[model samples]
Target: MKQTRTVRQSIVVSAVLLSVLFFLPLAVIEPFRAELFGRETPVEESEPEVGKLDGEVMLQVLNGDMVEEMNLGTYLMGVVRSEMPASFEEEALKAQAVAARTYTLYKIETGGNHGDTADICTDSTCCQAWISEQSARENWGDQADTYAEKIETAVRDTDGQVILYDGAPILAVFHSSSAGLTRASGQVWLNDLPYLQAVDSPEPEDAIPNYYSRAEFSAEEFKSRVMQAYPEADLTGEISTWIQNPVTDEAGSVETVTIGGITMKGSQVRTILGLRSACFEWETEGNTLIFYVTGYGHGVGLSQYGANEMAKEGADWLEIVTHYYTGVTVGPYTPAALQAP
Candidate 1:
């Protein structure tokens, strides 16, 4: 009986000790485990970086002989507002923004025409036209807010974007309209840029205001203008013999003509006569010389009216730019890459 009781007591003591050993370590490790788990709080995610103009661009605005420095985005808004009609489609406005940006960067990289002090000038006859938001609003009048918002949206949507050719910014020249086609760079300018070659621009003639224009000058006025530029010309003959052997391009723009025995390019004549474009048909109506002209501007690159028509046809900005520019890429604009060596 005594042995049985002693064995039972020993088993009971072993059971108590085993339970104590198991519970003691858990008690000791509870605080550390809690601390380890507490240190593992959920990590917060960071927000994405928004696209913005890398740096400010200096603009030598010819407003009251004042130079205005502005961010590239702001400058683009002003340029788009001034260059393209704000009533244009959104995609067309976007395309204009990219072209304007690319042109500005190209000028900046090429040392522009403003010497070393100014990056660009605001004169439309020289560089691209630019108008302040205030000026644009005033010009827009009752449509001010709507037009301003449209231009701002275009600039913001195309922020930091530029047109690139061969990994460099291209000379993105644009015009108001074309004579059913854009002129090749060689035809209009001195050198022919490969990307600026002639392209068909099929848009509604009625889309552009004053697509066709007529200018009549008296024989004496014509002779005076022509002789003023070329004083050595022989103008003692009849009007029919005075202008002869006119050669025209594919788009019907006068390539060259003999005026009083002096051959002059159509561009020179356009400049001399203050005609709308080089594409003109002239006839001697009695003593008055009448010129029927089509299109407006130099017609070397993108046509703004054509762009609007394309946009109306559901083409995006990228599509419109690539279509007009030819074999160029649209890429992000980096100020560092545009710096002059």
Candidate 2:
């Protein structure tokens, strides 16, 4: 593919246009916690910082009910181990480490919504996923040593480095896979960010055990489910007409889907139906309503599988992240403040 084959410049990065073009009137299924109907921010671009940092940072991380004081280095090890598969390419893993670091700092600066208990949380549903070295070892079994070294190297190689937009840490959100293209943050959330725009995420279409999946619902069951979320929806007529016009965005994912006289975001429908991704198509087969979904996760930021493909094709970590994150710069950063004391 053009994205993987391009000779990426080392220091600067630009979004790959092909990745942002239409893939499907596509979608996300991300581990995001932001409010969908909240206030939106205007999209803006800024110059990212370019420099190096000298010392490690510290953080107070929420691990269940307890908050533990941890160093950036230690926390990132657990995160890379838990969040990404150990078998991914080394450059891909390194990109994940940097993204995790930038996200941590972003959370800290934003006064994370975890009350006042910690700087960040370990819950993958709300924040990033993390696992201790011991648990990682037991899980990896015989390959434990090899995986441990790889994870450590991924973290160490990118220490203090981050992807920045406008001289601060970018949100740095990422997801597992995309439907040939990633989403712009504005399309999925309340804000449109220049660094988080839609881009080509050309990972292998059949790259996994569940890249494509199906969910089937009988007409009665479907009506019941839709009514549960929207009691006002009129799903009484022909099942086919119930899911009316779907308008797609520039990214190729549906922007709005009119279901049973009620219009909602494709993401809202995806949540109600428990689909793998927001990029989906629905069909009626007699009494059954079947949804065909493509990709996994929110389809924003870096596509983990896409990055791995780039790395496999010899693209470095910098190229991997920059391609997915629009126009961003990679550099070392010293936190405005470490984690909350």
Candidate 3:
């Protein structure tokens, strides 16, 4: 009787200890695990990973110009984490794993290596001619590495291939302030390059050629601008030509202008344009001469600031992507899954 009682007591103690150990982690860890992961806490129900996409779909994505100018690698990591449930669903986790594996192979085979830096000119001067000059600088700032990591992860996750043309990475350029829906801007640079030396301020002489409307607007506005400043002058030929020509030997009249709380100076007309004064107008979309411009480029794909905003707002990767790119599903690209197996 004594031996049996001792054995029973030992068994009961072991069971209680095991239970305590098991519940300890759930009590201590699960609640705050998401904080460590840099993601929202997983809901009680399991979230499933999307099934693999077809090869045709992957091929189409590669062939077609459907790409976001972001850090592919970082994007992939977010996708993987977002689609997965912390508790792990076998099928969903398996699919994500397979997709990740396949994407790695695809990147290696496609020569979409993300090492070499093509000539990226990010200096205010280099891309200052851009319509969304401020935005361009922000995108290409010190956060390039973070963006690059996201892009690399995305390519790896999607099994997406990058098409190299002429031994160079085909640039799917992203820029702010594209005039109209067209990507054309007063400023552009090789998509891969960064680092530019500012030669001059945002003025006509320093302004890069307008790739979209050419000098059409400038030509029309230049003469009127000069005449408005100096009414008693023998202005001949075209005022546009004078605006295009540099006023060497001496500085033109200087004036102060403020944009977004930052102050700058230029000739009276130049300052007005720099400040985006209503010196000129464009009659488009209901004939309302819109003056206060906010964003700089075609508001499509991913807005860099918008994405960062989402990130800061504690939105996970899936939410960030869906907010910008509508009518698209987040899924992995796999060969066997695509094939009739």
Candidate 4:
């Protein structure tokens, strides 16, 4: 059971997002349909025969120019395969399935953002990454059947289960990994969601690929990058004094950093420098600014590697989901409105 949070705790900051949860697990993306750059595309709404089953929830997934509709089970399988490694513990895969399903429902409830063309999209930037069976097979190679079974079993076991907060679907966002701790939703986004709070995420560094990386930019290159984003940044100085006064959260994610005399969020700096995550240390080597980054994606909600580790430690799917997501319940949900008439 979750402890009753104090009034002060309810208004804490949140950490936003990334493509960290899906696809490569190394990239970053926001939940729902909001995306970096201009990921939303205008596509022709095609007339489709949405063959409705008795109680099955259907999904319209925009793949490039085409919108493919499939039952929730099939879509969850593809999403799980694309979002997480099939070789992970079955429990971890199950958790991912539940998270994906909950996110899908939340999107539909919030109204389709991809115009009238799709309820969601294959673009990881826009929504979540989805791979077709053929594509998944090609990627899995000889182990395709085994991998497919693992993912399918995960979806089957979870069935129509979703993680709900107060009887409504919670925004089940996830990330690849974190710097030992997960971030709250407000630290990364505008809203500090009650379920998306910072928590203990015990993902070891070495186990996660690209968990630690270094980026070196010449003083001139760094100035150019900073100038393009923040023209007010005072880059005219000793390169060593360029970045100062970094305010960090309990999760060790930089909340704000004074860069070149301009105050900016750590996430903004991550984007300006193409850093893997906001957890970073910097130094000046000669005329180059070197940043040593730790972890991947925005540090919020479920940590994919952390979930896998928890599963490895014998936590079930529900336990894993509820642990990272804070207050939530796992159960079946097919609204009367969505059922076949």
lDDT (Cα, 0-100) at 27 in candidate 4? 35
lDDT of candidate 1 over 1-341, digit per residue (tens): 99999999999999999999999998997778848666554589532221356233445444337776555676777689899999999999999999998998888888788775577767777778988888888899999989988888888788778899998889999998888888888876689898897888865788688899999998899999999999988887777678889998888988789999999888889999999888888998888889999999888789999999999999999999999998899998665743323
The sequence of per-residue lDDT tens digits that candidate 3 reaches over residues 1-341 is 99999999999999999999999988898778878667885569422222233223321112112333222232333333433321222222223333333333344344433323311111223211111223333554775445433433343444433222333222222222212221111112223122111111112211213322311234335445545655554445533223222221121212233322233333233333443221222222231222232233322233333444344456554554434333334443333322333
Candidate 4: what lDDT?
A: 0.83
lDDT of each: 0.83, 0.82, 0.33, 0.83
Candidate 1 residue pairs in backbone clash = none
Residue 12, model 1: lDDT of 100
Candidate 1: lDDT of 123? 76
Clash number for model 4? 17
Ranking by lDDT: 1, 4, 2, 3
lDDT of 4 at 230: 89
Query: What TM-score does candidate 2 reach?
Result: 0.81
Model 4 lDDT tens row, 117-236: 877877888788888777888999999989988887788877878889899888999999999899888878789999999889879777889999999999999999999998888888
Q: Who is ahead in lDDT, 1 or 3? A: 1
Q: Give per-model TM-scores.
A: 0.81, 0.81, 0.25, 0.82
